[model samples]
Target: MNITYNQFLISDDKSLLQLDAICGFLGRSYWADRWSRETIAKSIENSLCYGIYDGGKQIGFARVVTDYATMYWLCDVYVDETYRGTGIGKKLIESITSSDELGGLSGILGTKDAHGLYEQYGFVRIPDRFMRKFPG
Candidate 1:
């Protein structure tokens, strides 16, 4: 799906992704600070990626890893520092949640500091119901 809001555009077009911009953002992000470009590219390859752009430049991104039936994990959500507070992130989330591809699926995400933001979108915290095993 492709959507435009104000000066920003959000699309699921993998061909439109700017790997350099994505790597630059995610590499410096608190969650994926140590992630390599190769890893990022691989993740994009395996997931449904949403790219938020300003005209021709990429400025924000989010991805969903899912089977499109049972479960989905929302991850690597970020907007350029200059673009925060503009509702781009919320729009991105709305786009993902409303998309036909993810309809009726159970959605989950892990955020150390964005609980309030997610809660606004109907995401509720269920204590101790989830677990993760990160690779070393």
Candidate 2:
């Protein structure tokens, strides 16, 4: 099946559904506990959301939180288990990186198992450069 990546439109019904479904399947960390259809829709309305479609069904998703001026944080990226190993993730990252809106900005993401994948897109771990503290 051919895959295509397109910008997510907030007002579109199908787009909203696809967004919620993707969040349901792949959202982790704080997102898994906090994201709702309404919240996801709002974020899509505000940020850069991309949906990956296989044939006609939505099968992957990614979004970048950026100022469009200096920095971009790529998040909420995932391919359906059935669609893994098929280059959808790479395409999504490529699409985001190549977009004019995200151009010339520092893009970053934190991944637990896909360092190799992100490396292909030029993402690297900044060892000891940053630290995190989760709220109790």
Each prediction's TM-score versus the true structure: 0.96, 0.75
Q: Model 2 TM-score?
A: 0.75
Best by lDDT: 1
Superposed by TM-score, candidate 1 places the C-alpha of residue 81 at a distance from the truth, in angstroms, of 0.2
Candidate 2 per-residue C-alpha lDDT over 1-136 given as tens digits, one digit per residue, 9 for 90 to 100: 1223443211123343365567665554445447676777777777777777655567667777888899998877777787777666777677677667775789888877789888887788888787789868
- Model 1 per-residue lDDT tens digits across residues 1-136: 9999889999999999999999998987899989888999999999999999998999999989999889899999999999999999999998888889986898999998999999887789989988889887
Clashing pairs in 2: none
Q: Which stretches of candidate 2 lie over 4 Å from their true place?
A: 1-17, 27-34, 133-136
TM-score of 1: 0.96
CA deviation > 4 Å runs, candidate 1: none
